[model samples]
Target: MSKVVLITGASSGIGKSIAIFLTEKGYNVYGTSRNPKNIESFPFKLIALDVLKVDTINDAVNFIIKQEGKLDILINNAGMGITGPIEDTPTDEMRAVFNTNLFGAIDVMKAVLPQMRQQKSGVIVNVTSIAGYMGLPFRGLYSATKGALETITEATSMEVKPFGIKVVCVAPGDFATNIAAGRYHTPVFENSAYKENYQMNLDLMDAHVSEGMDPIEMAKAVHRIIETKNPKIHYKLGGFLEKFSIVLKRILPDRVYEKMLMNHYKL
Candidate 1:
């Protein structure tokens, strides 16, 4: 039997690439999207789902369980990004982002855990970002979602370890994807704190995505994780710059890192 895996947010970008690659590699991949039927016909099955919908998530998992008999891998790749200062980002919008990014990952994980527990083996990967570990200005809330995901991954990994389940977090930096264009860039403030300091930070984020990692880089990383018998707790990948940023953030003092960020992004 081919290994059965389910991926969310599989309509495009890294998710789409991973689906295509894994399918070619003989995994029985089931890809979920908001408009699954609209997707062009392919070898893998398309599942109609909105990650935010609890019933939709349940139905999709049930369908997979019936067809595949057991679920072996789950790629919690569905997420949304928003760009704005944390203070100014509206409450509703914050939940909206969290709904798809954090809550949705949890929803799917909950739905899939039973089968994995029964089988006594499985792997779950959450595609977080470098910002998940280190915060940056003008993207406080967006970073918060990924940070929460990384935390849940850590906690969940330890909790599920006894069940022979592995949870992995992948923090890739600035992949070439529609996430930049899809970013919800609301005029998040009328009278907000740090209003004056946000200009350069926003510009830095824009430039970083415009010329950063390719989506395939992320897809390849996903492939590597899936093939491993025991994947690491966390994986970080991207170009030289993103890896260096992660390292420097670890070594440099808080004030020193702040200064380096200001200098690097010219803030």
Candidate 2:
């Protein structure tokens, strides 16, 4: 029987690309969106799933397992971005962003893990970001969420290895996707302390994402990882600059890296 794969946030962007790519490879793929109605037609199935809601997450997993009898892969790609100064960002807004980016992914992981554990042969890939490697000025909260997920992915990989379940994190630098369209821009209070640089930083970030690597490129990398019998714990996907940036951040002194990032954003 063909392997069954479940992908969250597959309505568009990288998620959509991965779903279509895997299906072409002959995997039985089921994708998800908060509102399935919004998803356009595709060869694979589309299931209504709001990762933030525990019940819907469970329902989606249950439906897939019921139909396929086994799930071979789970890709946690549902995430949201929040942009603003850390001080001015409201607590509720931060929580909502974390809920979608961090907690929501965890919810789906919890739902699918049991079956994966039982099968003793499955893969779980969490879609993280290169932003997770460093804290950007206006995107601090978004960075924190991905960083947290990356840490979790590391821990989960070790814990589940003995059970034959491989947990990996695919960190992409920037993908040309509609993510910016749905991203949350925290309200910048007039005369606020960060007003001067906040908009500039936000605009720069948006422009970088718009010009980032193609979503299909990211999907192809993921497909390669999925085919590997034992993929590495972390896979970084991006162009030369993006990939080198991560390495430079690791090797450079703290102050130097900070200055590099600040200079890049013209801060």
Candidate 3:
């Protein structure tokens, strides 16, 4: 039997591309999305799943195991971006963002670990982001969410290594995907300290997406890691600038970087 690979957030962007690439390579791919009915027809199975709900994670796994008889890989990729100025971002928004990014990924990881443990071999790739390593202007929440996953994956790797499981937190830089296709969650906050600043940043972020790297570029990296005999703790992939940005973040002072962002965006 072809290795069974299950991908969460498989509807679009990096998730969908990975599914297609892996499927073409002969892995029996199972994709989970909050809206399973809308998924296009494919050789693999599609199951309804909301990673925020632990039960949904369970069902997705069970469905795959029943069909494939074994699970070889789990790619936690379902998440959303919460973009706005940090001060203007509502408390509820922060909770909701983490609920989806950090908590949701954790639920899926817990759900799949049992099966993977029993088999004593499996590959887990958490779809983290460049935000995890360094902060982005007006993207504090999004950065925080991915950052949480980065830390979680680190501790998780050590615990699961003894069980013969390989865990990877793959952080991608800007990728041209529907995620950056547009910014939809605009907040209509009443008079606030950061209202105008927030709008300007949103516009800038949207502009960034319009000029980002292709999402397929990220998918290819994911496929390579899954196929490899062993994967690294973290894979920071993409254009050379991504690496340089992290390096700059280390040397630059806090306010110096803040001024750079403000000046670039003309905030």
Best by lDDT: 2
lDDT of 3 by residue, 105-136 (tens): 99999988999999999999999988788667
TM-score for candidate 3: 0.93
Which residue runs of candidate 1 sit more than 4 Å off their true CA positions? 188-200
Total clashes for model 2:
0
Model 2: CA > 4 A from native: none
Worst 10 residues of 2 by lDDT: 35-44
Model 1 TM: 0.93
Where does candidate 3 stray beyond 4 Å? 181-190
- Candidate 3, 115: how far from true, in Å? 0.9
- Per-model TM-score on C-alpha atoms: 0.93, 0.98, 0.93
Candidate 2 per-residue lDDT, tens place, 193-257, comes to 88878988878878888998899998899999999987998899988877888899989999999
Question: How large an RMSD does model 3 have?
Answer: 1.9
Candidate 2: Cα lDDT at 134: 87
| Candidate 1: tens digits of C-alpha lDDT, residues 143-238 | 899999999999999999999999999998887777877778757355766655666566667777878777877788899998898889989987
Query: What lDDT score belongs to each candidate, Candidate 1 first?
Result: 0.86, 0.91, 0.83
